[model samples]
Target: MNDSARAKPLPTPETQHYWDGAAAGELRLQRCQACSKAYFPPRPFCPACGSRGVRVFAASGKATLYSYIINHRAAPGFTAPYAIAVVQLAEGPRLMTNIIDCPQTPEALVLDMALEVAFQKLDDTITLPVFRPAGA
Candidate 1:
């Protein structure tokens, strides 16, 4: 599918840094300074302690395949048989993404399989952080 046909992300002030990091080939996440907990879906306040002291930093880009589902039905921007996955980042946060560079099958996408971040640039401003086998 073409880039224009894909559903793009709308970057907000709270999440702008994340999108920027993806464009730079780095996976960035927010950590609560007060609680020292890493989290996804960036926000000004820490969800654990309600503290507004949150810092954005580069993630290790290392993750594991926590869970996934193979979608047989195609969407506007996605092809069928794609794995919609939840990857657990090394820092303790999980994010929904697509698994690429591998066959989309249950036997192939094993739970706890090592994976790493792979950016998919949808446009000049929107780059998605997908995942693939760690060494692939």
Candidate 2:
């Protein structure tokens, strides 16, 4: 596959902080000052209470394997049998991401397994935050 086939995240004003944090090797999330709830996939307002009083904070790069599927069919720029996962972050939010640095099998992709962030730079300005078994 060519680089053009790879899907890249475009940073918008609401999500620019997220992309910038990824580029700087940090996991930035927004917390509502009104209700003290933190959320992800960056939004202009707090998802919890619809409050505009949100603040960006760095999150620990810790998460647990929530759920996943082993995709055995090739698609776009990905190889077959890759795990598409939803990881529950320590900060109370879940993200859909790909697991890396381990065998893509049920035995290896255990639910509730500990994970840490791993950034894969797609270009000069875009970095994807994948996860791997923590300490692997």
Candidate 3:
């Protein structure tokens, strides 16, 4: 990880499991046991049905390119001309992430392109899940 890396997310009690899973190289999500709806940005209660009975499970780590912007200005912990993107996960949730291991250009980043998770170990306790073209 670079010294200028962006600020890391602080893990709270409700969201710690997700961070732990990321550190362990797994993308974890909370599913409402009652509603069976999978969600992201972990919360204490299910957004779909107001169920407190939620279970944390590993996600398939598959997604498709939904949206993006090629940033030309440098930002904290990142270089200029990088792609900031949103991926629609196979589990029916969308996540904001950086698209990695590919050219940061419009022609290279096609809409609905297949992606697979790649963990970038930022530190000892935090590993961010980024994506790259599947099998690329």
Residues 1-136, candidate 3, lDDT per residue (tens digit)? 2555688988999989988998998999989999999998899899999999999999999999999999998688887898999999999999999888899999999999999988998888888999999998
Q: Could you estimate the TM-score for every candidate?
A: 0.96, 0.96, 0.95
Q: What is the C-alpha RMSD of each candidate to the true structure, in Å?
A: 0.9, 1.0, 1.3
Compose the digit string of candidate 1's lDDT tens values, residues 17-105.
Answer: 99999999989999999999999988888999999999999999999999988999867787787899999999999999999999999
lDDT of every model, 2 decimals: 0.92, 0.91, 0.92
Better of 2 and 3 by TM-score: 2
Of the two candidates 1 and 3, the one with more favorable TM-score, higher being better, is: 1
* Pairs that collide, model 1: none
The list of candidate 2 runs beyond 4 A from truth reads none
lDDT of 2 by residue, 1-136 (tens): 5666978888988899999988999889889999999898899799879999999999998999999999988778888878999999999999999999999999999999999988888888998888999999
**Candidate 3 residue pairs in backbone clash:** 4-77, 5-77
Q: How does candidate 2 score on lDDT?
A: 0.91
- The per-prediction tally of clashing pairs is 0, 0, 2
Superposition error at 5 for model 3 (Å):
4.8
TM-score between model 1 and native: 0.96
